[model samples]
Target: MKKNDIIITYGTHISKMVRMVLDKAELALSIPKNARIGIKPNLVVAKTHDSGATTSPLMVEALIQYLQEHGFYDIIILEGSWIGDDTKRAFSISGIEKVAEKYKVPLLDTKDDTYCKIQAGPIEMEISKTALDLDFIITMPVLKGHCQTKITGALKNFKGCLSDKEKRHFHTLGLHRPIAYLNTVLHPGFILMDGLCGDLDFEEGGNPVPMNRIVAGLDPVLIDSYVASAMGYEPDEIDYIKMAAELGVGSMDLEHANLMVLEKDTCPVKTIRSRKVQALAKAVTEKNACSACYANLIQALARLEERGLLSYYKKHPVCIGQTFRDQSGNSLGIGSCTCRFIHSVPGCPPATADILKGLLTGLNTK
Candidate 1:
């Protein structure tokens, strides 16, 4: 599908923007009008009103109305919040339960099912048995800023579709790998973002920003790329989006994008969630800058960052491995006769000069 026609409509009354964004990309299809359809939304947390946190019920209602007008009304609004918060409770609180009643559809919370975990490569994800059993699925996500990934688009929203364990386990692979893998396996037939001025810095619990934009597309990766650009972030800054591009899940590059900026004034958004991180390769010659010393230094820095001691380290990937005069952590260490304490290190340590250079350049541009 060439551009898949991503629609980025503006304004706050979300449903209007949602309908405008989705009207063309997801056409009035004739595929079993009364099919058992599932509309997956980002009910990640329970918040009052739209608040630009989760998918607005009005946005889903708008889609339901669209489908109904097209003679397809049988559908189920399904979701399961991975966090301990009750998905059913969240649905009811978020106004989705009332939408289900009005639409005459079921609000199925997948957490209630006796599910089985399937090994998708080295990772196991808890998927909804009932949703998977559906004939049609529609991925409806609220476009927002993510702590790890710059923007949480349709793909990240799908992570909620899996069981709770799978969602938490993703942190094991550092948050990006498992996300990329999961997106490759399952994708929505159509993606409609409930953006219309969504989040920018944080997704569920952070203050909201008015992105006044609702985008829809077939390619989850491409949709994310658009959301990132709209948010003024370098698409490549988000590793998950990059991973999706590398896996051919979808393209992050917008040059080949057949995007239709519907009713947008082309506002330039800020590129946040980026910072400076670097590691130096030190030879055994210097003790002050040795591997252990660097470890302690980095550990202190990381601890400080974690406690909000340093705000600059947020969302920045640590780039390391330039050769220093210390050998405790060098590429294929020639003299490794000391320092028995070690946790995890990449196979090859990058040179100190390279790491510093990259960091300097990255920070200067920002």
Candidate 2:
């Protein structure tokens, strides 16, 4: 596969799939044999791959085996799970630790790695020192929906390389522009996406839709653009993908991309958009609500849907953020920014459980 091209191989035999793509792309010839390679995979939460929230261990193992075969031994598996989750726990739960042990490759938890400030375009963010020192970075991100960004792929996975403080700061910076800026500075050389089974609605994953395929590519922006299309969305729907393209990260123009399919597509693309999420989002009046706070609310609504309780508040809107500062009355509110509201759940970003409880009680009262 060429830089602008994407290859999709169908099946669960991850190792074989990895080998096929590497040979097809002749990716080894592009990198220095003795280069220090860093492999970053998404293990955002302490959950198994079956939960559709993390990268598959089999894929990572296959990548390690392929790289080792090509004489690349100075490889490290690195990741920093999202702020509130433990990276160690994610490694254990996602079964990546066993793969690391078998390959004799050290696992570097970026959560514990020291970071140094780096300027990427107009943005200056702290990135992991070890990540900065790598000769080549191979990104392995799960293709999944995101509450804030609409979707998370190759570019979004780089957030793991930042310190926990910087991760939070990205949210404060409104996520999209900062993400685009970060990629300008910290670009991954290659991307092998874990697309076997991914959640359709949330980044943290619960609903696993088995697509039974692995996607490989070199262009991060193009890869995300293709993923956005497969997941029933245009690339422009994801703000960062468009922003990154404008910043010259890569092209978001799928029409110009060289898309290659190695095997027949077993799982045809379906509209994975959840109606419950749509309805709940319609009830949300947000103005700069942070990703965590907004995601917690979405998760809470998902839980309510599971319990068949979503219909109760179908017509009720939830007010959040600084814009609703002195707002009150019938609408339920979330976060400390909505303190003046009578039914606000108080926290800078309320806990998921608390958000759930607030939804149940606040909506019931009305």
Candidate 3:
């Protein structure tokens, strides 16, 4: 498929949908027979594919079957879940382990893999050696909402290839620039997006909205730009996408993209989910917060909102992020950086449940 070509197929049969798109795109023709291929999927959390936090194992299996059928056997599945989550557990719970076992393909958990320092543009980060060893990468990221970046797609999925330390560092570097730079270093040859169902607001995936389709493309920036527009935002709203385009990663010009839809009259009109995160974020006073920490706080606030307890934070406006370091505060703080705060739930990036518990306890005392 050409770099500017994007193919879409719609159906409930994920395996058939994947095979149809791959075949039509002629993705196999682009790879050499002896190439070491890595299938990177979004196992960001230990949730089933139905939960909308992960890529479908059925889709992965279909890709594997298609590759093997196309005489491509040097294939492996590799991924690392977000920090505070176990990759092994995610693989198992997400049904990807069984798919690997059935196909007799190796599953490399990048969390346990060694790293190599790579420099891209002005940013340098440690990427997994196993990921770097691959001749080509097929990124399968779930199209989802991100609390921090507003959206997550092809470019954001590459964060899984970074060491856990580098992942944290990316967040500290404000996420956007580092993410854009990471793609400049490790660009995937092909992208197959899981548009089946993705969480509407948070990356961790609790509230799912079903949009039964699969999107295939060669350009991450272009695909992400399309994703941003489809998800009710302008391409420029996502900083990394625009930065990656500027850094020569890929074009964000969707107008020139050759979009082809296979299935007839099945492309659902994109609908915008309520911006609950925007409303909930009013209670937060954040500065350079990491994705994980910010996500946990958002989920916690969502839970509080459900219980009609979110109002307790209007006056408090919970503080979080690196800038809170060495600063004393009277308001509730969410992470270890705000240790000087009178009320603090302390972890470098505290768990959602723990954040909720802390908020509940504070509410009771008040």
Candidate 4:
């Protein structure tokens, strides 16, 4: 596919849909037959693809099958689950291991791989060696909402290729700047987004909203900018996308993007702003907050909202972010940065479920 082209198709048959997009995008023709191809999917958690938190094994298998049929055999699937999660377990739980076995393709857990430092723009970070060794990389990211960045698509998916230390460090650097810089150093040859069903409010995925589509493109910035618009946010609202555009990663101009819809499904789904998310966000007092920490708070608040326990937050607004560090307060706070507060959920970015339980127990005591 050309860098400016974005091919899309819709269906419930996951394998057929993926093949359709790949064929239409001319993805096979764009790569060398002898190239070492790495298929990178978002396995941020140990969850089934239906959970909408990870890429579908059916999609990956289809791509692999298509590649082999096209005379490209040097293929491998690699990924690193988000910090505190196990990639090997994710591969099993997500059914990717079965796909790897079926294709006789080895699965590389980047978490266990060595890394090399790379400089991009004014920033330097370590990336997994396996990722750098690949001649071509196909990134398959789930198009989903993120509490901090607002959305995660093609651009943010590259975070999986970094070392665990670098992944954690990306958050402390505010996520956007480092994500943008990383793209300069590592560019995916192609991007295939899982738009079938994705959680609309959180990245780890529980509340899946089905859209029943697959999107393929060559430009991360262009695809992500379109994703931002589709998810009800301006491209500029997603800091990394805008930054990547400025750093000359790719174009963000959707007006010029060649959008091709091979098969538009009937009753197409469109993203709408969640009233619950709006109400929950009002309860947070954030300043320069990290994505993980903020996302955890949002997930916790969402649980509280569902349980009809969010009323407690009305009186005690939740505080989060770097600005809250070393600051003492009587209010409830959400991360280690806000530890000085009277009530704080500790951890650099505490687990969402833990945050939920902590808020329920701690707020009840207040």
lDDT of each: 0.61, 0.81, 0.84, 0.82
lDDT (tens digit, per residue) of candidate 4 on 1-366: 678998977667789989889888888888976999999999999999767689989999999999999998999999999997899999999999999999999999998899998987777889999999999999999988887898899999989998999998999999999999999988899999998777766789876656567899999999998777656456887899999999999999988989888874533223324565567777888777754355446656765775688887876678877889999988877778888887888875554555776778776788
TM-score for each of the candidates = 0.69, 0.74, 0.74, 0.74
Please give, for residues 65-90, the per-residue lDDT of candidate 3 as tens digits. 99999889999899989998999999
**RMSD of each candidate?**
14.5, 13.9, 14.6, 13.8
Query: In angstroms, how far off is 147's CA in candidate 3?
Result: 0.2
lDDT of 1: 0.61
> Lowest lDDT 10-mer window, candidate 4?
264-273
The candidate that wins on lDDT is 3
The ten-residue window of minimal lDDT in model 1 covers: 276-285
Query: Which residues of candidate 3, in runs, are more than 4 Å off?
Result: 265-366
- Candidate 2 CA-lDDT value: 0.81
**Residue 141 accuracy (lDDT) in model 4:** 94
Task: Supply candidate 4's per-residue lDDT for 313.
Answer: 83
**lDDT for each residue of candidate 1 in 142-229, tens digit (9 for 90 to 100):** 7676776657887788777777776778876787888887877676777877765455446774445444556777888888877665
Higher-ranked by lDDT: 1 or 3: 3
Candidate 3, run of 10 with poorest lDDT: 264-273
Rate residue 308 of model 1 by lDDT: 50
